[model samples]
Target: MKVNRFGRQAIVAGAAVATASMLLAGCTGTSSSPTASADPNATLVFGITADPTQTIPWTTTSEQSVQVLSQIYSPLLTTNKDDQPVANLADLPKVSSDGLTYTFTLKDGLKFSNGSALDSADVKYTYEKIMDPASKASSRSYLASVASIDTPSPTTVVVHLSKPDASFPSGLTAVNTGIVPSDVSVDSLQTTPVGSGPYKWAGRVANESISLERNPDFFGGKPGAAKVEFRIIPDDQSMVSALKTGSVDVAIFDNPVTAKTAVSNKTKSMEAASLQYHVLQLRAASPVLSNVNSRLAIQCAISRQDVIDTAALGSGTVTGPITSPEYRSDPKAQPCAKQDLKKAKEYMQKAGTPDGFTLNVMTSQGLYSTAVDEAQNVQAQLGKVGIKVNVQALDSNAYVQKWLAGDFDAAIAQNAGSADPNTMYARYFTSGGTYNKVAGYSSPELDKLFADGIATTDTAKRKTVYTQLSKELVDNAAWVWLFTPKEYIVLNSSVTGFEARYDADVSTLWKASLS
Candidate 1:
């Protein structure tokens, strides 16, 4: 499931930026911050969770890859903190009256960091390549609305779609869909992607680090950090320690407790709601869980507040299917299931007189530390209602395999539906969704609602449709909604101009400077 796997990798990618020395330091503690570089712009080091799977956007799902690629390539658009689409590499596309065709105008005098002139041809080529059947772009389904591309002039590119899609602009803001030079081959792109962005790839040291230098000729203006080095530190605890010791200038902490540990007068921290949320997936095929009453009882049994307080360290919000709080502002949108043991017992009575059934809930030790804690908390909550849940924590890869195979009765995991509401909800609830295949869920009404939600550009109509969808999923007990995890970024006092993006994209560092 894309949600279970994809964006969560980025949590560690940005959070581990300040922990390079922690990996080498072992257990010997060093609480001192590193001395600031005499020249902040000369070099800046960022600790990342893991090395990117690949540098190219089309084939990779890792968030670390997206962070690296966001700096190497510029997308047609980007999103604000609210996830609203805004123009970046090009101005907003002018849509046809029928909404099937979009006309874009590129900025004047655009050039890649490699000195190649960038224009509409590059955009046409990149989109066409993604649309090709053999390209195997992970986002092909996301951008399937596009039927063909036409470049009428050097600065103008027109896209014809199979149908009208109001949320199409949001797809343009994806990091993997960045525009690249037309001449760069698929093989060349995998190794060294060239694009018109603020920075250019400089060097790579396998699993240790990846380096990028400021693009002197970039149209957006040269980056503040002349040289940026992203160091890989796999352990989260160590990463936080590195931030405290000043081995690295910046790091991201997924653990709020660890983030607090790194906070000091010399280092500052900011905690924001994450795009991803932890969830408990109940197997629809399981005879015990298949019953609607049982599912609702399970939902009512779990306490979101307890999970947040115990597992998340009070840094998260109880969430619904949408997860992101920004989209839940609508007055009519449905909220998550409230904790009601009375309701749970009543529903359990309807499910053939509850006599305590054992639910094996799986989790990943390597994914998020909170997964086990949340699972354990849920286990305790369900116990109160005569449901025994056995929490199983496994290695990440093994857990992913088990999850994809649908081998467990239940699983605790995290998923991000993307910034678009349609994409977010459709991914798990709609029939034949990425995660639904395992759950064996099929609903024609949900399919229709998702189809309509993406069909129109009208904000009011979209909200109404999604609000209904949320209520349906919650009422059906589609999944146990948990808390949206908080992402904490720790930065030294010397780093300036670093604004935290709602998503995991680290491209904002293009403007960041270190003292």
Candidate 2:
């Protein structure tokens, strides 16, 4: 699932200014050589910014949780480096000619971490739970097309869809759809998950750390690291220190300044383009934002480039709603690509608020390293257009609670984008989508666009459909699109074989080992 994932810190205005100045200084550091050959039994300590909100795979919308759960739970299908669905616990599915049914065959021998047999019943049960309304799974909307699951035999599962969905296999690749033993209770799995993944749950300390060990019963051979510990280090600088002191063998940094600092300290690093992007979501149901003109005023008032410069040290690309290369919308083509104070004021006048109005913008304090800075910059820009904005900076947990409940007039969010447009937007843009309430606006036209985007497997036709959808969203100011920040993976010199993925996934850590 595409959800919030970042370290948390209290809001401090001076932090942004300090980071910006450091960026201008052009920091550099010498490289270090590897000390020894890779060790398969070594324990790799991963430095993370925040603790996972929960460990339940299906119920969570937190990326932090996905990072941990992914290692413990194995999905029937997993995405390859190209972001295409590939076989994992089962072989590639066989699709019916009409595209409404999918048949999957389990591998010869599949066993959960606990040694229990995993079969078609487990796969069927997993999808059924996600489709159940009471489950409240964040990925529920992704599986909405599912009509029923038939387990014809212990090794085979047949899924029936209510309608044709070209992106269905990709949806199954998500961590939220990771298969589990049908006999395991949800309550037990929440704390002690059992699955057929490379690693098994070892232990966790509330907010300090979580550990995992190799799953001896895994179908896949032994992983590179025998044990992995995710050390929850909330402060970026502290995380850098941990890397320097050898306490953290690997870490991912969203803040360019901190990433540069780690490199300067002789740590090796790689930059990966992320599908995640910053966005300003306006609640169309709110009194001040009810009128499309009001939303347009806010969209035109702020500059996406300025936000990137101030918040991300200018290390990002301004983008619209979609970030996937195949169907990405051009930022230059967006109606409010360039800031126009005059146009903003005119729109405000048309909105019947020419004199001015106040809006509450909720943001996570240190979520994604620059959330507060982005909100503050937006506040200043909107002020110029006589749109008073009150920034409500909350802790990451509180911010997520409010964000999920649609509790604010406006919100600054870092949402995950997908390789497929439907996976990226359907949850928030479609009429029956799970997060449509959070979006606060939807129509027949918008829903139809989503339907068309997923109705066929034709790549060119799907691209055309998404292009129109992008236009509709930008034209109506559905969201004030911002920029996609560069995700930095910093590793100590002794760590090797770590590869980065475009989606900023850390699951590849299974292949990383200490030298």
Candidate 3:
């Protein structure tokens, strides 16, 4: 959705630094010139699949990784073009005189793709469903602040919360907040969808492809690129090949490979600086990761710079865990490295396991080129400090399910999309925070600090709260933090009107033009 763009690892290069130079020199997406003149009838073809890797809203996270699910879905609110919090399903929300409640005014003429009115019921239903643990939304962090939602009327919806949730508005825009109609309490998501976005589902083509047609009455208005056909090519080489052969105009990827040969007439690309943060998630439920000393030892042993040099190719900045600058705004947010192998061993020994431990680490495949390699490097590096790591790789579909199940010791994943620091930090740090305790952590200090953050709308106060929380989260060694990559996009010079948004939704047809 925001600060949005992507690439992948396909071509092998000489070294980490060498590959990084390739990224620095060839990476695209941030257009050097303004978008071309708006061509209303322009049919801009992008490379993507109509078939979503996973249609399950709760678990189907990551903006660019899953393309259609984002466009066809609606969150409570979304980050608008200006990168400011704006209403998506709800009109700019107004807080009650009492800070505990909030009411949203619905857009009168809204309807889902299936021709159902987008009423307060849908809003209430969606929120409740997402809040339920069974829904298993990957961005379950979105509902952490929500206590409940009440439909006062068809057009007016009221939200009741345990506390004053200042970040509630921002959470609404998250992909995880996409509305669901049926009464689903941990049940499976509907195979067919009824979204309120600019595109409508035409049909699913096997497990690999899906098709979409533009909604003439899309809320923001119709997109210039009509009849979008999403062809899923799970292989990075295949995806890049599809784009290169002109079989598809746009495709989503997260490696530096596409940029390597972008000078040819495939299509221009965009490299967006994303708020999406990649982190090493240690299941708090796990025996080894559960121990603070073990976690600290693992954190110190990680070579974050290697991950950046090999994986992201020096394109993005090294940021601490939960590195969301737009929301956190912390001054001391530098990447941490727990050096002194002797000390890491000491932490392990103090945890009463001087011999260290062996664990499995799983990361989603085709998501990032460097994650697996980084995982390998991490395993080797950690071994020097006494930890043995086994790496497992899976596709996007299985990745979501396994991560939510907390089956692995460490899961390497991104924040997916939310740029709001409040949303990112609270989801993974607060007590019972959906993504927070993924590492199964319970820090009263972090909880108290995060609570104070969501209480006030004041920017300075919010920033201060977020800063303190981030520092503590990193210091505790809950997970190893890595670089926050700049969202990258590539495009042909003919394409125009592209701008990098912070909140993930980078494609807005209205703002685009063509030669």
Candidates in order have lDDT scores of 0.71, 0.81, 0.64
Sequence-dependent TM-score of model 2: 0.92
2 versus 3: better TM-score goes to: 2
lDDT of 1 by residue, 1-515 (tens): 11112122324433343352232122111122366443545677888766665677665454567778888888888777667788788889899999999998988989987788899999888887776757756555556678888888999989999988776888788776788888778788777778777889888988789998888877777687888888877676677677778888888666655666677766876554467767888877776688878888888887887777666655577777774443562312333256889888888888875765778888876555567667777888999999988888786556756776678888887776566776565545666454465554548888888888888878778778777777777778767778777676787767766767674447667777776
Model 1 residue 185 distance off true place after TM-score fit, in angstroms = 4.0
Model 3 spans with C-alpha error above 4 angstroms: 1-45, 48-51, 62-66, 138-141, 147-152, 180-189, 326-338, 492-499, 503-515
lDDT score for residue 25 of model 2: 32
| Candidate 3 RMSD to the correct structure | 4.5
**In lDDT terms, which candidate is top?**
2
- If scored against the real structure, what TM-score would every candidate get? 0.81, 0.92, 0.85
Best by TM-score: 2
* Full candidate order by lDDT, most accurate first: 2, 1, 3
Off by over 4 Å in 2: 1-35, 264-266
Model 1 residue 267 lDDT score: 80
